[model samples]
Target chain A: MNPLRIAPTDETPTVNFIPDEGKFEISGNSYPENSTKFYSPVLDWLRRFCAEAKNQKITLDFNFDYFNTSSAKYILEILRILQDCQKNGNECLVRWHYLEEDTDMQEAGEDYRDSIDLNFEFVVREDTL
Target chain B: MTDKQLLYAYNGEMSNPVLNKILSTIQTKLSALGEKRNVVKNVNTILIECCQNLIYHAKDKDTLKEDFFPSVSIYKDAGGYRISTRNVVAGEDAQKLEAYLAKLNAFSPEELKNFYKERLTDGKISAKGGGGLGLLNMIRASKDGKLVYRFDPVNEQYLMFTLSFLM
Candidate 1:
């Protein structure tokens, strides 16, 4: 399947999902007015990828500076989907990145790591944009 | 400027574009306040959550009075910054929110963290993608791990819901 790329807006994040290379990423702030509408297609792509992707190893990267509560729910949903993919015998790893000084984002990643059973790595980058 | 003065306040209809404008305006004001980067970010996050809560959950817009229109404000306090929002909600929704806030206020910081984790994967996403995590996130974001709220009954059908976070 072809890759999916969504440009980020003031209230949304940029989503880059590449099924061919098994590289998926979501970055930037996400606090859309209608989060369900914004995330429906991304969730659909993940479902399709999990069902049809032939890649044996998948790495999903999440680098979010800030997201509202509704977006947080969808982020958890995406992680849950990847967890299911891992459970179905696919090698999957999630690189959760945050600014070194942003403890809130780091703790958010930790919260997801604690909730989902998957290979998760927390990467702290510099606080530069 | 007074230390505990009101920094920003808006009392009117809050749409998506208006929310964005409010956020940017507040961000600029906060920058001018010369707060630390982390402090500014924390305040910004809390403001976004509170404003979005008003935007998404506010009901009976057509019947809103001038004083009861959806509103949000930021204040500088002795401890830290406080963000507050007020909107109209149905009586049923107000009851649910009051109960939820009571439950959240009962938890310690660590317990709230656990509760947030549990609710994240509860698979009960609402049509608006709420999944019942907004209040918990607010409480966790608050410096005191507490969300202050009040419900003023307007009539048999609707009530005023006010939520505030100190961060």
Candidate 2:
């Protein structure tokens, strides 16, 4: 699988998917002008990558400040893929990193954790930028 | 300047940069008045989505020769910023929008949040259907704040819906 990385802009976030190291990350605000135009490839890559899985421990980190509805949908798709990986006997860990004071992000993370059976770790840190 | 003055100044034609400047100016002013960073950001997102909604779908049959689009207004009241839009849409669409508005009015904060999450689960990452979530986000942003709304008619064929976020 090819390394997937999309840089963040004022309207969207940065996405990094490294299959070789089994490390992935998505961070920033995601309210793109056209959400599908932005997220289709990411979903396709995830779909293809999961079909050809290795027994590596996967660590995916998410540190989004905000996201729109369309972006939110794609995020859940990514999580569902990770959940699939976990169910298939791969060690998948979701590290949901949020700002220290951003209760919304924390609550959102909790919401996802409650609905999904994926093993996730919620961590908070200062905005530190 | 007054809202009518601002609306009249458009003259049915505006350069992209000028219109963007106007939209950005209104957004900046309202965001500053909202005070909270998240609230400001929410307002910014809503206004952008709302304007895009207008640009895409605002249609009026009688005004074939006129600029049949939406009129966005940012004003003040005893409470907070009153951002509004008057877009000419189809009668059927107006009814559908009213249904959505009624649904929004009926939902509590928890209900809105739950609905957003559920839709996030069910829906694909599409732009058109994302309109519903934008409305939900506006509702979420004003959970503890204020949301005032009204509907009016400009001609016999169109309905104008005004949504206000009370700072």
Candidate 3:
């Protein structure tokens, strides 16, 4: 399958999903003007990826500086897709990265972790942006 | 300079570019002053949600009279940072917003968090692409769950809406 690579913009996040390597990462800020239009394709690609790749090891990293509420919904949807992938026998691990001093981002990670059934590793580090 | 400092202010169209510029300007100023990381993030978050709400819900500039231009500003006072927005909305929308804010103001912090997650997962996103989460997020970030807002009659069909809260 073809990889999905979307470069980050001033108002959106980077999305790099490589099926061959089983590594996906979405990092940076996400507050696009049209969140639905921006996230529709990413959700489609994820569904297709989850269906095709069975019993594989997958790693998804989410490192967000800031995301609006609309983007927050889409992020939850992304995690839900990964939850389905885990249910299909894939060993799925989500690395939730946040700035060491950003309690908002850290709490956001915890909220996403509480909703979905996945192995979530909350990693705190210095700012990388 | 006065203790009540006007850090950043915008008065005009609530376009995406303007919103980004506002956020960027505030981010730079706050970072330069070594503001607390979380406070800066919260301030930006509040600004985005507020401005986006204006972009989606406010009446078209062409339709409104000259004095009703949508505006947003960030300033610092004795209480800390404050973000405020002024916009014009239809009477019906104004009513709905008032009731919604009243309902949100009644929730405890834990209740608000639970409600936010519930809406995030299950609520329908509006035609304008909002899940009706903007005010919720603002109140979530506002100091002590206080979201001060008011509406004044602009005309027979529209109302002037003003919303502000502390960081």
Q: TM-score of every model? A: 0.92, 0.78, 0.95
- In order, the interface RMSDs are 1.5, 3.4, 1.3
TM-score order of candidates, top first: 3, 1, 2
Q: Candidate 2 residues B24-118, lDDT tens each?
A: 67656655565555544445555655554554454544553354545666556554455665556667777887788778778877787788778
lDDT of 3 by residue, A8-100 (tens): 998899999999999999998898877989999999999999999878999999988878888898898999999998998999999999888
lDDT of 3: 0.87
TM-score of 1: 0.92
Best by lDDT: 3
Q: Quick one: how many clashes does candidate 2 have? A: 0
If you assessed candidate 2 against the hidden native complex, which CAPRI class would it receive? acceptable
lDDT tens digits, residue span A33-127, model 2: 56777777888998788878867788889988657666777778788988887777788889999776666677778888877888889988774
Residue-level lDDT of model 1, residues B1-167, one tens digit each, is 44777999999887778878887887788888887666677777877777777766766646567867888888888878888888888888777878888989999988987787777777676765555676777788788888888989877788888888788
Error of 3 at B101 (Å): 0.8
Which candidate, 1 or 3, has the higher DockQ? 3
Q: Largest DockQ belongs to which candidate?
A: 3
Is 1 or 2 the stronger prediction by TM-score?
1
True lDDT of residue A42, candidate 3: 99
For each model, chain A TM-score?
Answer: 0.95, 0.93, 0.96
